[model samples]
Target chain A: MAQKKNIKNRATSKPSSLVWIMLILLIMGEFFLYAWSRVQCTRMGYEITREENKYKNQMNMRNNLQIELSRLKSPKRISLIAKTRLGLIRPAPKQTVIIR
Target chain B: MKFDNHKQISRRAAIIGIMFAGLFIMIGIRVIFLQTVQGPWLSKKAANQYEKSVIIRGKRGIIFDAAHREMAVSIQATSLAAYPGRIKNKNEAARKLSNILKIRFKNLRRKLETGRSFVWLKRQATPRQVQAVKALNLKGIGFIPEFNRFYPNKTLGAQVLGFSGIDGRGLEGLEFYYNAYLKGSERKIRVLTDALGRQFDTGQTNANGLGGNNIILTIDGNIQYITETALEEAAKKYNAESGIAIVMAPATGAILAMAHYPFFNPNAFNSFSRDRWRNRSITDSFEPGSTMKIFSAAAALDSGICDPNTIFYCENGEYRIGRNIIHDTKPHGWLSVQQIIKVSSNIGTVKVAEKVGGRSLYNLFKKFGFGNKTGVDCPGESTGSLSFYNKWSNIDKGTISFGQGVSVSALQLTSAAAAIANDGILMKPYLVQAITDQNGRLIQNFSPQKIHQVISARTARDLKRIMETVMTEGGTGVLAALEGYTVCGKTGTAQKVSTHGGYSKDKYIASFLGFAPAKKPEIVILVILDEPKKEHYGGIVAGPAFKKIAHQTLQYLNFTPLRQKKHQRVLAENEVSG
Candidate 1:
């Protein structure tokens, strides 16, 4: 009878040790996942900042180019070029034709 | 002895247990105190380590012309700043920056060596300079983004658009008037920084709404350019002290062009004199000279006191009133009002003024918007002087009748002429057409406003006919006549009020005020030249410019010549007959 009791006790000890090992593995996995997510969040933050800066720079460049285009299209400059470089003159009143 | 030893051991164990319990209780109380009493302060202190609050200013608004062409724009530029205490090897940094920035070495060095904790190295640095500085990667130097106002057309409409200062405050012109709407608002935002003091998060802030609302003006850029060119050429040709020209749409009262001579670039406004910075057309008033005859005739005709054919005996070149002798440029006999206006006879105008009476003429001038501000959107509008009829002596009435004693701004005269052109209805003049957001959404629209009618439609037509005679062969404004279009105009030559007291003998303000397509006038143009050296006659000096501007503007408006219209009508009639 005593030998039977000792066998039963050994069987219970084996299951408990297995359960302990499983719990420990599960905790380790959770820690690693939390750490990985944290690192990803930080990396994404840096990337977003870089992209925002690039977007701002591009917007500035567009504004500058638009201003430059306006300057180039100024009437004074166009008229000057037309008169001097292109050798053009404004048509007289009678020379111009109007389409109905 | 054994039992005694057992009791002693029990006592010692119990005392040590109590001591350990007391120590734990103290620790618990301390924790509670820290959590309750100083939690918020500690949390804030921790946040300061990696978080910052920064103030951001929105970009200033843009100014667009009638056709949506950019007149003034704001662009992002980098400003260089320095921490004097953090800078090492200041001499080398200053030397390098001086070369790149085109600043004097001594000045740059002095700025760098200042005792202040922070100082501006340069404001609104060029892109090339910023690039050179960044390439150097010098310590303690940093760049701040700022908006710089740029006038793309330079001097095209400088006096109208005005300019803003470095701090983004408007100091003159429409800029000064609309500064509140053009200036951006300030916003505060929180940002997260990393250990290296680099921003990692921009935080939750919508910055787009903070920018100023953009302005759209009624000024036509092409028309403004044409007017400025013509005015400059005319002023230079005549060697006048200054000049002003205004173009207005008769029906809408939209000022298409307001040009001032001696132009200055708003981009470099500081380099020009303050005198040149003024929009003289709106700010300064001058005698309209004989141009006032058109209004006088309108007054006489509108009051039904005199018709276009009312014969007034012009004193054959000179007429006496009280103590003053009013002389016509040339002798005139018993001339009808039409002929009198054609020749710009001063005596005839005075006689018409006499029949209309001082009170009636004053009321007419007031009705034409001579003595009050037109309430134009531009800054610094002058209410041209028109003394009360109660204060007018006989001489004042005669002089005022021919535009000698009274004064009128270029804008007021243009608007009054526009009233006549619009067939007796006076429309309030305006420059700004609308206000828009950054995304091109309409915020507000300025529509045309009509003031009271100054004359009856029939009288306005008769007055237009009499005025058209001024552009005929014997008229004083004969030079201002367009080849294919009928022009209604008046010429004015008023002697300037001499500094000593009376009118100057040689100095004169010669002007031409007129409109084209007399039957349905589309545009009214007023051109004035102050102190012309070449000639003092209004027709000789200012009539040609009036003609050029009127012709070009009418052509631009796509008005077909009367002769062409007639030919086209004839062709259509023949086609119908077939």
Candidate 2:
């Protein structure tokens, strides 16, 4: 009778399909969470890069404008214009007054 | 049996643990190597792969007058640039900008289509135009903050103040002289921003960021204005080709006002020509005519070679020296050296020069700061011309005796004249009073620096007395008299040298060098008018201008004569110096 009972218990110990399904689900869940966070991180990084590029471009334009402004103000250029364009002359003491 | 088994197990366990400890040590050593030596290299490699750095620029400094008035300043401006690759609608952007900024739309469109990453749509746009562009909110269109120089005073003291470039650096005058002290320290910062574009503090920080310094000039704005105004009026009234005026403190050498005609506004620098932009006070050189006699006379007095009572036998107004006949406007038989200077007698000054000798006169000229730079801190300064004594020609010496055959800048002439006003002490001509940092700490200070006492106090006093006589009825001193004020001055009508070596026939530089209250002068004024169309005589063309200007200046400074009571003195009391 004991030998017959041992044979019956061994027959009932085969692996169930439900255990395999549960293990697959756990691995898939972790992978999905990792993928989602990675997408979020990449998006954040892209935004920062874009903002930096924008600032860089703005600064370059500013530099160019500053150069233009200075070029316009050079003494040589102004003097050229004043002498050729405007009919002006130096002042004289006889014409102007001197006060203490 | 269990105890024996336990002892064997413990011994085996200890042996295995020692092997594990060695493995752990090996891994720890690897980590130390990676962190200590290779970390920087790896980090740099990583940065090279992903990071890009661009240099940031510093803003230039603003310009201000002595009165703390903004002569030039930075205003927020925008530039329109295009990302050629990103520009999907070049025509649209150009049209929009042209409409908003009033730019040449066709030109801008052509620039945008050049297939470059960046094309400037506009530079230095006004605030309204920038706002207009921003309102459009167009994509790929951008603006950068920039500063532009503005001149609020227009053409006032334009040459003296000079013009700045886009970088806001001084190119001339006070601007160039104090450039180093004006340019401030620069700084850089690594910044972090949040999603809302607000500035966020980063643990990483940097210093070395700085703004420009401020310069406090010795020029008084009101004085400059009045001086310039009077100069303008005189130039117009006299129908003169060019004119220059300067007001300075006799003792301190502090330049209060320097006025020149044909000045150009720094903002509109391009609108004028270079010839009109120089400060004549320092740049232009001419024979000072009678003004030169004052120096010669002072030299004779200081060296005890001649005194006020010294008399010279005049050859009835015409004298011959070394095959050259020198003539005076009026011939007097006998005259004292003092009377000669008082009358501005060319023949008389020549006689005095003969007795003093040429070398003595030249040495005196050097002592009086002629033929040398005034040591003024201005660029383009020309040291007046003094032919070497060793190289002197007899004719040159004779001509130089009466203010010819040599040249002196307006600065040199005026400064020498100032010596007499300041009791014979020559002072350095200073334009900038002080230089301060951004926080207003003084970096430089200019005080009353005396070059030397070129003449004794008594000599100066005597020269003053002689100059006083020139303004009186006895001399060519009719036009330069200031009513109610004791005026002493000299009149000069120098024949301008022709480029061909002789004097120009019609062209003359008429000038008057004068100071007030002969006993104790508070101000010294030198006026020069080149090629006057009306009266060419220094006393007539340059003199009346002196009277008018001096009158206005005295009122401006609240100056009153020493002997005359305020408002009680008659106009006759102020007679023209002879």
Candidate 3:
């Protein structure tokens, strides 16, 4: 009777198929997470590079615009336009009245 | 028989195995030789074939006026370029590009047909041209980004600000003087490329830690414009060869505006002559003529040997020293020290100089910064010509007393006059007011620098009073007088020095140096006209210009006339009551 009981316990000690299935699924999940993170890192690197280039281009455009604006507001240009287009003339000292 | 056959086979197998092992040993030796000796050389050669580096230029700094208006700035521009080897249909490309770039078709075609890999279509193209070229989108044509210097105010302060060349190097004026501070740093990018010559990795390294610094000058744009227009008109009206007007703050020695006629537009500086590029105020020296009388009077007063009431004999407009005879414009009898200056009598000035003695006069000249550079932060300054006291003969002393033998730059004359206006203290003249870094952080700030005390405050006050008489009704510089404000000034009519070492009778330099509201001075202005055809007198030619500049400048500064002061107060009181 004792020998028969020990044989019965040994027969029941092998792992079930369901346990094997869970181990395979966990390994596949780890591989998927690793692939996702790698893809995310590569994508972020490209985005950062694009943004840096955009920033540089914007700065160039801003500097160009500033030069243009300053040129338009120059004294000679303003005075010329005032005389020709606006028909303006410099006021004489007698004509101007200081409030204070 | 079986045993013999088996032994023979074993011997043959052993010999073959030994030969195979020897071949393996030879191969291992060759591997070690290649790894140890040729590995580094081969790898470097490969890297040389695929690696690339490019230089990134930092932006050049901006130049600003005292009011923070942009006088000069560096702007980003695109230059059209081409890889000739890659360009197919060269004629068609050239024809289309020439139309857009406004270049000749033949020239563009020749450039595109060159054997070289790269060629420039245009450097620093206009924006409209660049846009037009971009619209074509031709193959092998590309654009290179570059920095171009732009002067928005055109000819305003051209000589003072100078100009940078297309290559961004400063070539003249303040641009050349402060180049090291105004030039920007550069960056280098080292790229690692693959076998196909495509870049795979890059390391960006800055060559310098800091960018260029911006310069804020003491020049005021409005005042500069005013001075320039007034000087231009004076030059034209007088039919003069050229003109210079310098406006300065007397107390601080800060130059507000330095105007030059025959002004060149820095944007098109090349279209003008190189002579126009000179900043004549500091670069050229000439006889001060009677402008030196004010200094002579200062010497006499400061020496304690004479006062404004001191008397001297004029020798009836003719005085002989050695073999040289000096003549005044008009004959005069005995005149007071104040009267000598008021009439600008040459004979009177010589008699006073004799009383002061030669060594004392030379010392006075030295104290007034004659024969020396003012050390203003400008390029091409002349030290002027003043002989040593030991070299002075009686004739030299007499001629120099009337401002003929000695010479000085307009800048030096202005600085000396400014000392009187600043209560006898001479300040070092400077154009740059402050230096700022790229991020607008102040790196250095310049303030008023007092160099020496040229005269006593009492002497300066006395000299001011005497100079004021120069603009009175009977004086020479009456044209320089403002209606309500007192103008203390001296007029100069100097004969031009000929190349043969003699004076030209026909040519003269007319100049007026003065400051307004004499009691409490604000601005000292100098106007000099070279070779006025219509008028040869300083009081008649340059004095009116001085008055105009002072009046406009005073009005711009809101310095009310003494008559206007009471009127303004009453108006204010009335407004408040209403």
Candidate 4:
């Protein structure tokens, strides 16, 4: 009976060792892939933020120009200059055109 | 022999077994290092790599006039730029962008093809331009939201309102003066985003956003518009070198409307000349001329030296002192202090000054805010030239009494007259009344400040009565009269002295200073037309301009005619008489 028990223990040991090796390989592969993807994600976030800041600065420059244009075109200011410097008067009723 | 055969004790089997054992041992060592020695380092690295981050942006503030009308504000707009690294076809992208953005194709191609990874496609593109380009669906092009300030009432009070900078900071005027209160704090926000540039489903708000403060001026927009319009008309018609018109609230010393010629639109500061930027009201000085007579008379009256009924021989519009004979525009034989002001007689004023004496006259002018700064919120102001009474010769005092040998700004003249209107009390002139926070809370309020009481109410009342006679039929301001309204005013036709060449024959500064409704005044207007070529008389050049502005303002304010409603009694009597 002692001889039979010894043979049975030897029989189970080999496959168990093989099974543990395979599990170890699988875990390492998954870990490497997860680390690689994490690096890529971080890079992408940096790129997006850099781009966003650039866009904001560009927008700021544009808005400043628009404000200047609107202010220059304001009627109250231009009309005064016209009347004072250029000797232009408001258009009389006969001078205006009403088109349909 | 039996154990070796059953176990298959081959060399290959032994080698494989040893290798597997070594691999397991390596993993065990690594696990020990990770869980014990290097765990904190690995955890920090992971946090840095994977933690979500976000940035917060702040919006700028808006500017408003005295009446809480929008003078300037930051508005949201879309700006276009390109990601050159992402473009599939550079040539195609350039063509498409040029068509939609209305930019030159060659320029677009050159900019896009630059080695830089990104470039600006356009800035501050119109909404139509934005839509057209976005509809093209170019892969490399993108837009972002930004704000720019908008001045709605441009150039209305250009000098007084001043201007701002690109980062929404105030550069000049009230904008620079109250910038700290206008610009709000900057805030930062943390956000999460996906690889495709999509934000998280929900984002959090940043508590501290860049905000600016709100400003309230003392300017009435309607009145300013009117004053500016009439002044422009007069300046052009008379071929004057430069012009200025100012209206003030006498009791509070608040400048209602102050307009300067050769003015600039602060929005386009870069496009204008520096001359246009000069705010002459506080920045320049001119001879006060006959306007100084009112202050001189105030001094004489306040000293109890001259009464209103006091008479003086005019020498028939010409008086000689030390070989200097001052001539009047019109001649008068014998005149009281009231008629002297009405005719704007230089000789009469000289005689009054002679009786009033130099020391007393100088003191009176000093008390009415001359020979010193009014402490206005503007950047530059001259105290004006009022020589010390002891410093002046007898002839100098006499010339000063008739409004020569002294200089003052349009603002100084107005402020002094304001004291007269405010019952001899001088108030500090201010343009900005208050500054409010973004939430519409009143952060500050400016009260009506009286700097000094220069004269007694009785003297002021008497001065007002005399100044009013000058606006009636007997006065210089007959032209300043509004239709069917009793007006009070004084005119100054000052001689222009050339710095190098002594005095110019044709150059004269014609100015009018006055208030409305001879009995109870509502508004005070001052018009100064400098070096008017076509017209030389103050009544002819400046009087009508003041009249138009005051009349329109009173009509707009719905101020009743000076004469009470005798029409009601007349109508009732007519019905009974009939």
Whole-model lDDT per candidate: 0.91, 0.76, 0.88, 0.79
lDDT of 4 by residue, B1-578 (tens): 88778577676788888999899899999999998999999987765554455444455556666667666777767789888888879999899889888999999999888889878878667889999988888897878655555566667788776777655677777667667776656555545555566553232533233567677888877788889888888889998888999998787899888988756777678798777776788878888688878887887788898889899998877778887777887778999998889888888888888888877787778888787999887776778788899988867888888777888878899999888888888999988788777767888898888899999999989999998888777677788877646666889888899877766788999999998765666678899998898888888899999998887777666665533344555777999999
- Quote each prediction's TM-score: 0.95, 0.75, 0.86, 0.77
Interface CA root-mean-square deviation for model 4:
9.4
Which portions of model 4 show Cα errors greater than 4 Å?
A1-100, B5-57, B80-123, B132-142, B205-209, B331-333, B569-578
B-chain TM-score of model 4: 0.86
Candidate 1 local lDDT, A1-100, one digit each (tens): 9999999999999999999999999999999999999999999988988887787788888989999999999999999999999999987877776896
Compared with the true structure, model 2 gives a TM-score of 0.75
Instruction: Give stretches of model 2 more than 4 Å off.
Output: A1-100, B1-76, B193-209, B563-578
lDDT of 1 by residue, B506-554 (tens): 9999899999889899889999999999899999899999998988888
Off by over 4 Å in 3: A1-42, A80-100, B1-51, B88-99, B102-117, B136-139, B191-210, B568-578
Candidates ranked by lDDT, best first?
Answer: 1, 3, 4, 2
In candidate 1, stretches whose alpha carbon ends up further than 4 angstroms from where it belongs are: B1-33, B203-206, B573-578
What would the per-residue lDDT of candidate 4 be over residues A1-100, giving only the tens digit for each residue?
Answer: 9999999999999899998998898899899889999888777766766676567567666856666665665556776698899999743222332222
Top lDDT prediction, candidate number: 1
Error of 3 at B200 (Å): 8.6
- Assess the local accuracy of residue B501 in candidate 3 as a C-alpha lDDT between 0 and 100: 80
Please give fnat for model 4: 0.13
10 residues in a row with least lDDT, candidate 2 chain B: B199-208
